[model samples]
Target: MMILSWRRRRGGHRTSKPAFVEDNPGMDLAIPTHFLCPISLDLMKDPVTLSTGITYDRESIEKWIEAGNEICPVTNQVLENFDQIPNHAIRRMIQDWCVENCARGMERIPTPRIPVAPRDVLEICSKIMTATQRGDHKKCMELVEKIKRWGRESERNKKCIIENGSGCVLSALFESFSSISIQEHEYLLGETLSLLIWMFPLGSEGQSKLGTAPSLRCMAWFLKERNISSCQNVILVLKELFSSDEKHVNAFAEIEGVEEDLVKIVKEQTCPKSTKASLMVIFHLISSSTSSEKTISIFLELGLVSLVLEILAGPERSMSEKALRILDSICNWEQGIKKASDNALTMPVLVKKILRVSNLATDFSVSAILKLCKSQEGGDHQQVEALQLGGFHKLLVLLQVGCGEKTKEKVTELLKLLNQQRGRLDCFDSSMDFKYLKRPSL
Candidate 1:
């Protein structure tokens, strides 16, 4: 059972021939069977010979590796190693075959360049660092562009770059951003940040180094730049750098205007991915119990409460969930409770999002409202507003719907609080049974 494949011509037409058409009535062209990859059944662009004596395209084999296969596809034998040796001989033959069949509408395949080796990547990065240190801006920029191209060219090159101390090199480059002139800083730092984002998932040590005072200053500069890409990259890198590191989180919060800039990004940036990245960073920083009162005040003054309310009102479930979680974190603090309680929209949004987004979102929203209602700052107006916004009905629904234990507890507490004030509130429906408001046992 053989398959026939069509090769597209330069004039936007395709020509097909049987796999083994030695003598056809109308056509005589035959494509060599071995010229096609076994996996894709297509002509190989960059043919690579595996250990099991099978030749496949580089991309196909890499995808196989990425799929967690540890053996050759054709032979089903354990591969000695995953090294993909370029089959230049077979590649040349394929190119020659394409050239010969060009008149028959076959497109000629160009020769693939040898992939950059780890040693070469290491040396180029070393030269880049030396050039940067020597103030050879032109040389440094050129090498930086080359590395960027290499990183973007193939995952193989990126892996090679990362394996050969690219993290340390990037950390050094990020640190140098503070010393560069303002005119050149944007271009250089922009290029460096783009590279960093590409080669992310940095090690803990590398992350700590990159989160230094100088690198953070450079990131601050990125936020102020008119280039939106740099701003997005800054948030992404910070998100990775600050994950699970309390020291880095504290350091990041201490960056002058960092919180304000993050709030601005959430409000003004149109890219949802970047906005989420900014939100995650903000969540990590403000969620920390170690976050100072001054830090909380800074966020409040920068309108974090209003921004979160606006996001919760939107239709994105993920963003709303994240916003709710951040609200829950901040609301634990006295300052956060006061700020969220003061905002007219916070209580309403909290009540609306419960059971509307997801279980996690429901839990966080319930927790935020509970904190606000328990606070001494939550006066009659806020409490009445919650009830008017159908808070009591939502609590009853949440109890019946079987939410998490903690959520049930919070709902019960909120229901009890509202029940106490029910006589004075017109929105409360007293006709409904209140038996379901009993708190769940621990």
Candidate 2:
């Protein structure tokens, strides 16, 4: 409505203006051309001029530069330098424009403070390095907190922290604290772990260093801490480390009580993120080549089957997917099959999820069901249970929708297994009779 009123100004003559588009693409407002940032095509909140003679919103341009783009977004020319001069005149113009239209629900953008520079990040990292080496816990944590603030400030600040190799310093700080007892430095460990995970997908060097037994052991100990944030960060870092190198899996397997803590995180459902991370960690541990047997044994002893069944029965999608994958992975063993089959929900839940959740879920569910059926000595009872639960129908739907070759193969074998049972011959007649006999008997 304000835009319509603005269009009728100056003796009822409409002023041709460039329309604002980015934030609200559908609304074509009479926004001044000079008020917009070329990159975002939106009103510039903090206009800054680049050396390439182009002015853009500071946040947008900083993100572009930090993303390693050498050419300007507007100019498309090679950047000789990365200096952004504040466009004070343009900023003032935008502010005045907003002020003129303040009665129309237009809000003014606040002035942005000076951004953190690479030199600033490097200086703080230097202080961290020195403080860490000097064994100054107070100053070290203070500096680490400062770095964390900078990192949380913006993506540009995070890039600066990473580009300046803060990971090197942070990992060193972690190792230094690892040798110390967590009980004495719980706060320090929480802060360091949070920051380390913040700058995740650590460089190869950092990964190799942190993936060591001692580093992992220290992290595992941190898992037992009562701090929820610390547990989330430690599990996330562990996920990253395990993802980077499979050897960490075996190393983690050797750590006592680590699996218990991970299972507890899932059982208690501390947070959705931590639960998913915990499940991922377990999946990786089970996927390990050399230590998988021991890992499976430990997880089974910890009641993982029941826990996974509980997760699957919940309404969460991603967690259920991860839990199903874990179940399928573990089903290769007879003990895994026995544990899964012993649970009442295993067949019913797996059958319910077959064609219901997702393709991956269906694949896993089908695989687990096939394993359970085959694991039985008579196989008749399990097949009958599967057929009674409509596994046969779900598998047909799965085949129609299509699945992977392996999953298709598994489904085919499972269909044959269900079909060989006593109910298969009369399935069609039984279904028809049930439908026709829907009327209540008097």
Candidate 3:
């Protein structure tokens, strides 16, 4: 299976062919690629397109038009709108090549059409990171297997070099340790955050060798320790990270050292369960700072959403409230509101989730969202609807019935804001609030 991950634009955008593909076949392909498809001669996968802009499924595309499409196989430029299919001769040639290369073909051909050296292999792995950061999962999978192979070999070599004392070979691995640490000190966060897309399953091994795997949380600490608070870059990284991986829905996900840090912060007794400080760390990195997609995606990809939901669902009211605020933070990251628009997430669900979280919130906790919903004075209807969907009436009831001055204050603020949209309340008995409701219309 060809894992051809790529970053498509917001809509119908195409990425340029990777530079590795044009150089030598070895760098772009793990196995012999030349014999696969003569044109691009690379791995072929989903949405198999033709010169005429027609897309076929993997099997159908394989059956009808082997050797893949003649044009750039990555985007299916030829089949963009499907005016026509490729010439029969071209399809036949590709079909013949597929038959020859099929794992169960009649003739077993060994040795790749192209031979790959370690350098070429390394280059390919780096490109996988690039593709992943750009939200290109299809392209990332193209080299996954080869990436695993490289890791296994690199692992073996790292052990060998450490044991043999080959001129302190680790130091010469790349120009990084000093630079990596210096980069840490300078507080220069990543703009792309795409590295995390490749760090999964196989891409992380190269951190010691390729310098591609970036430590986002650790880097955040490094920045925080230095008071380097420019957050625009970190947020970009987080958004890109969320755009790629869906693994961040849990609290104790095992992601290198960073996961350990988050867990440590969450579990500490001395630390506020609300995790005000740590939340400040991640929130600053993701919502305020600029980072690569890898960092941004870590929030979404590493079970961060589910984790947030769980935290908001926890028994500790303040902590739960903080978690909901964090969810809102994730939603509000760089162009994140637009992200929610593009993804198929429902506003009602988010509201219901907010209500679920709010039900357990402390006096001031639930009010945070009321303040947020009222931010910018009702210019955004989606936010208002989210609060209402989360059972805004029930929340107001909770605030009303609860016998606390803080609760009253929050309700007062809520009513102040609600008055803006109160005109939509025509069905209500205008005296409803003045009657059975707690604290009486004020």
lDDT of 3 by residue, 1-442 (tens): 3423222112211224434434433432223332234333332322233554444433335443435544434554544432233344434444555455333222222222222344564566466556544534345444544444443454433333223322112212211332344343232122112222223222223323222233443344433332323232332333333333323212112334454344344444243522544554455445443444555666565555555555554565456555655656666544434443333343443444433444434333444445445555333564455444534564556564663676567666665655566556444334435225443222
Off by over 4 Å in 1: 1-29, 51-54, 63-82, 99-105, 129-136, 177-185, 379-381, 430-442
For candidate 2, what is the lDDT?
Answer: 0.78
Residue pairs that clash (backbone atoms under 3 angstroms), model 1: none
Best by TM-score: 1
Model 3, total clashes? 60
At residue 93, candidate 3 shows an lDDT of: 43
Using alpha carbons, what is the TM-score of model 1?
0.83
TM-score-based ranking: 1, 2, 3
Clashing pairs in 2: none
RMSD (CA, Å), each prediction: 5.3, 7.4, 19.9
lDDT of candidate 1 over 1-442, digit per residue (tens)? 3334342212222346433232433454566778777877777889999888899988889899889999999999999998889999999998898878776556678777778888798798789778768877677778889888887777788888888888778677667755666456667767888888766677776776687877777787778764788898888888878774667788767778887788888998579989999999988888776678888888888888888888888888889888888899889888888888877788878887777778888899888878787788655666677888888887887788688787788888888888777888765665777455433322
Tell me the tens digit of each residue's lDDT in model 2 across 1-442.
Answer: 1233332233221224323333344553466877777776667888999888889988779778878999989879998998999999899888887777554445566776667888898898899889878878889889889888887777767877888888878888777767666567668867888888877777887787677766788888878864788889988998888887887788778888888899989999979888899999999888667556767888999999999998998877788899999998888877787777778888899998875677778778888888888985635667888888877777776776668999999999988888778445455333422222121111
lDDT over C-alpha atoms for residue 438 of model 1: 35
